[model samples]
Target: MKNLIRTFALVTALLLPVAAAHATVLTETGLAESKVAASETYRLNVPTEKAVATTQVRLVIPAGVAVTRFQVMPGFTRTVETNADGLVTEVTWRGRIAPMEYARFFFQARNPEQAGTLSWKVYQTYADGSVVAWDDTDPDNTPASKTTVK
Candidate 1:
């Protein structure tokens, strides 16, 4: 009985990380219009799970889209960097989000003229200096949170 119990505990420990790897990104408001050339505003909420304090968050905007405006929630500092074509390439937020806490970010942008799906890639840094990336470039790798523009 003791050996069986030990084996069960080992299996549970191994599975914990896999279960915790899934992260969630949610929109505050309901779904937005998925039409091309449509103007949409998104309020994104990102929650931290295993990290004690989330120190930084980075988001990459999809090509062909224009980020007209963006704002970080109060208590955090934000910086926006644009590409040579004047489109927002990346948005970085520096703040503290305690474990189980969430950070809010808002942005308004126009969808690309073409109809398709846009993947927003995100990377997060913890107080311990570890990093978690939400890169969906390769489907086999971590899947990125997506927005569809039909």
Candidate 2:
């Protein structure tokens, strides 16, 4: 009985972190439809469920898309890095988000002239140094956000 109890406790301890991490929800809002048009400016708002500081977010833009402007809302310091193609590759924000509080990051981009769905992958890093990858090709694996161009 002692061994069984000990084993159960050990298993629970090892899985606690994994369970807590997934409990942290990262969701985006304000963008309607999975479709967008060329040269259109879209806003993406990411909200966090837990109190966190020093949140790093990376947004991968599709080829031919250009990020014209980007900004993080007040109360937070932000730094943006772009690729040679003039697309914003990553955006990092440092600040404190109270439990259930949200941070908004805005950006303007010129979409590709061609009409197709753009898969935007987002990677998030929490204050605890835990990284959650929102990039998954499979829908069952936290698939990337998608927007289709008309």
Candidate 3:
């Protein structure tokens, strides 16, 4: 009985990280089924699960969505890239998210006039210089957060 219990404990410990890796790392709120062509404030929730601090976050604005403003976050510098049409296509925030901590960034944007899903592709960089692209279909890694417009 002692040996069996020890084996079970070891298995549980080994599986914890796997379970965590599959968990959602980036969560988006306030954009679900928003009205078409309507402006809304959206929030992206970022959590750092690494031992090292998170150094940077980049969000790729989906096509047809026009981002107009950003709420400045303390301790972070914000940058925006625009397309030829002068619409913001990318927004990046440079800050430090300590180990086991999280941060929320807010922005206002006009939803697409047509009804469809918008997939928000985000990339997270750690202090160690490693990056994770949240554009995958696999849940084991980070996946793109999506919202629909009606």
What lDDT tens digits, residue by residue, belong to model 2 across residues 36-102?
4445555544555446643666666667667787654777777777776556766666666654655
- Which window of 10 residues has the lowest lDDT sum in candidate 2? 19-28
Displacement of residue 104 (Cα, Å) in model 2 is 1.9
**Stretches of model 1 off by over 4 angstroms after superposition:** 1-28, 137-141
Pick the winner on TM-score between candidates 1 and 2.
Answer: 1
Pick the lDDT winner: 3
CA lDDT, every prediction? 0.76, 0.60, 0.81
Evaluated against the true structure, the overall lDDT of model 1 is 0.76
lDDT score, candidate 3: 0.81
lDDT accuracy of residue 71 in candidate 1: 59
Q: Highest TM-score, which number? A: 3
For model 3, the superposed segments whose C-alpha errors exceed 4 Å read 1-31, 137-140
Q: How accurate locally is residue 16 in candidate 1, as Cα lDDT from 0 to 100?
A: 72
Error of 2 at 145 (Å): 1.1
Runs in model 2 with CA error above 4 Å?
1-37, 51-54
Q: What is the C-alpha lDDT profile of model 1 across 62-113, one tens digit per residue?
A: 8877889875478889988987777789988998989977777888888899
Q: What is the lDDT of residue 33 in candidate 3?
A: 61
